[model samples]
Target: METVEDVTRMHLVGGNLALDFVNTRTGPPVGPSDDDVLTGYPELVAWGAYAGVLTTSEAAALRRLSRDDPDGADATLSRALRTRDHLDEIFRPLAAGGAPSTSALARLRDDEADALGHAQLEGGSTYAWVWRADRTLARPLRPVVHAAVQLLTAGALDRVKGCGGCRFLFVDESKNRSRRWCSMDDCGTAEKMRRYVAARRVRARR
Candidate 1:
C-alpha cells in the first residue's frame, strides 16, 4: 500500500476536480481499495486546499472552526467521505466504459441541486455559479460538488479512463487520447521496469 501521509500526495493527476476527488482512495484493477489518505475532517479540508478547491484563508478558517466545533467537523467529514464514495460509484463504472447506476446519477443530480442552493451568480461579460461566502464546514466540499456537475455536463465521458497501471482515474487529454497511466514518472516507469525484467528472464531461460 502507498504510504500517503496526507493529501499533499493525492498526486492531483486526475486532470479534473471530480476525478481528483474520487481518487482520494485507490484500488486495484479488480479488487477493493485499502489505501485511504483522507482519514478525517482536517485531512479532508487539507485535501481541498491542496487540490486548490479551497483558498488558503478558507482552509485556515476551516481548521480553526474544526477546533471549536469538533462534532460539526466530524459531521462534515462524514458528508465529504460519503460524497467521495458517491462520486466513485458514479465515475468508476464510467471510467471502465460502463454506465453508472440510474440511482447514482439521480443522487448526483440531487447533490448538485443542494450545492447550487447555496450559490449566487456574478459576472461582467458572462455570469457563472459561485458559492456564497461563508464559514460553514461544508464549504470546502461545494466546489467539488460543482465540479462533479461540470464534468457530467461536459459531454466528454469517453475521455475518462481507469489507469492501466494503478487503476487511478484520469481523463486522456492527449491529442490522440492514448494516455494510459496516471503519471509517467510513477506508474509508467514501474510498468516498464517490470516488463524489462520479465523480458530479461525470458531471454536468460532461452
Candidate 2:
C-alpha cells in the first residue's frame, strides 16, 4: 500500500493535478480537502509531455526515493518543474483566445480513447494504459482545456479571468461578478485591509 508520503511524492514527480484529486491528504498532517485540492492545485496541469513515458520501475523508484530521501525527491521535483515550463508553452494559447472548439478538443479526447482501445486489446504496458486513460494524448493538459472551454463557450474570459495573487489561473464564478481577489479568505481580505490602511495613512499625511 502506498503511504500518504509516497503518493504525495509521486504526485510531485507526475506533476499532475489529477494526482491531487486522488490524494487522500493535504499538509501539516492534514487530511485532503476536496475544496483545497481543487483550489490550491499545485500541479501546473501541463506536464504530460515529460511525465507520460516513465516505465513502472522508474515510477516505483521515484516513489521509493521520495519516501526515503529529500534529495531524491527534490531532484525529481526539479525535473517536473522544467517539464512544467515546457507545458506552459503548449497551454498558453488555450487560455489566450486561440483555443480550439470543444469538438477540436474532443478530437484530442478521441485519440486517447482510441489508444485506450488498442491498449486494452494488446495490454502492453500499464504506464501506457495510464497515459491513455487521461483522455488526453498529453495527460496534464486537460485542466487547461477545461478552463479554456468554459471560458470560450461561456464567453466569460474578462469576468472569469485573472488571479490577483499571482499568475495562477482560475474561473471567478462569484455571484456578484465583482470578485477582485483570487481568494476572499486569503488574498481578498488581506489586500483589502492593506489598501484600507494605505488610504488611512494618506489621509493622515494630508
Candidate 3:
C-alpha cells in the first residue's frame, strides 16, 4: 500500500522536478542532494534499460547529463525530462495497444536500432560508453519502467520520484507509511538517533 507521498519520494526515472516532487523532509536532514542525483541516474537508466531497449546515444546523453555542472545542469535536466517523456508517451500507448497499429511500435523499434548502431560506432567498437551510465553506484531503477508499465497503463509519472532525503531514486515499498529517508539503514537510523538523544536531554532537564 504505497501512498502518494511514499511513491513520490522513492522513484525518479525522469527529471529534477521528479526529485523535488518527493521532497518530504522538514528538518536539516531533508531534501535530495545533488550528489544523490549524480549517483542515481545510473540506476534509473538501468531500470529503463531493463524496461525496454535504450539506444547508445540515449544512454550517452544520459551520461553527459550526469557530468558535473552547475549553471548548465538545468539544460541537462531538461533534456533528461524530454527524453523520458518521449519514452513514457511512446510506451504508454504501446502497453495499451492503442489504435491497433504496429506502425508506431515498428517505427520506434527501428529508430532505437538505428540509434544504437550509430552510438556503438561513435562510442567505439566495445560499446563501453553504454555502460558509463551503470558506474554511478546508485540504486538502479529496479525491474525497469517497461515492467512497471506492463503492470498498469497511464499511471502518474510522479510515482517515479527521487529521494526526499537524497537524489537516490527507489520504489517505495513501505507498508506502514513511514519511509521518509533515502535509506532506513542510513538517514532513518540517524534520525532515530537524534530523537533519542533529544529525548534523553529533555528527561535530564526535568
Candidate 4:
C-alpha cells in the first residue's frame, strides 16, 4: 500500500524545490497514465514535510484538519495539482527550449502573490521568507510558490532540464551543465541495460 503519511519514498531528483514538486508526477509528461505521488491531502502534507517545507507538527495538524474537513482538503489538493501543472507548463517547455503557455505563467504569477500574502519576511542577519498559519492546508505550497518564482528570476533558467529517460524535471547543477537522466541509479542504469540487451540480441541473430 502506498503510504499516505510518507512522501520521501518518491524520487526527489529535481534539485530545486519547485522542480521536485513538479517531479511528483511520473511517466510520460503528456500521457494519461502519468502517476501522481500526491493522491490526497495527507500525502500533500507528507510531501511538504519530505521536502522540508513543513514541520512534522505542521504536517500532523494538517492531517487532522483533513480528517475534520474533507471537502476543504479536496479543494486544497486540487489547487496544489493546478499549481503543479502550471509549473510543468513553465519548466517543461523551458527544458525543451520552448516557451510556456502565457496563461500558465499568469496563473503562477497570481499564485506567487497569494503565497506572499501568507508569508512574512523574517531573519536576524540574513532575511528569509517564512510562512504563517501552519494550520492552513495551503501552507506547504507557499514556499513552493516562492521557489518557483525564485528559480525563474535566478538567471539560471538554462540549467532547468527534463530527464532524457523520464518525465522528471531537474536543475542541471553540474559544473559543466552536462548532467542528463534523472539519476544514474534509475534511468541511466535502465538505459544501459537496454543497450546491452539489444547488443546481445544482435550478436545472437548473427
The models' CA-based lDDT, in order, is 0.84, 0.39, 0.39, 0.87
User: What is the C-alpha local distance difference test score of candidate 2?
Assistant: 0.39
- Runs in model 3 deviating more than 4 A are 1-33, 36-78, 81-164, 167-169
Instruction: Give the alpha carbon lDDT tens digit for every residue of 1-206 in model 2.
Output: 33333333433211223222222223321222222222111222212222344344444444454457656445544544433333333233343445434544555344345434434332545421333333322333333333233334555544433335433333446687665544566556777899999999999999
Instruction: List the candidate 2 regions with Cα displacement exceeding 4 Å.
Output: 1-62, 65-79, 90-160
lDDT of 3 at 90: 48
Worst 10 residues of 2 by lDDT: 37-46
For candidate 1, the lDDT comes to 0.84
Give per-residue CA lDDT, model 3, range 1-206, as digits (tens).
32323333443332322222222122232332232222234444433443344455655565565565433544433444443444444433432334313554454344344334333222455533232233321212212222333323444432343334443433344565345565667667877898999999999999
The Cα error of candidate 2 at residue 121, in Å, is 13
Query: By TM-score, how accurate is candidate 4?
Result: 0.93
Query: How do the residues 76-183 of candidate 4 rate in per-residue lDDT, one tens digit apiece?
Result: 999999999899889999999888999988999999998888888898999988995545878889999899989998748988888878899898989999988999
Order by lDDT, highest first: 4, 1, 3, 2
RMSD of 3: 12.8
Model 1 misplaced stretches (Cα beyond 4 Å): 1-5
lDDT score at residue 86, model 4, on the 0-100 scale: 93
- Clashes per candidate, residues 3 or more apart or on different chains: 0, 0, 6, 0
Superposed Cα deviation of residue 34, candidate 1 (Å)? 1.7
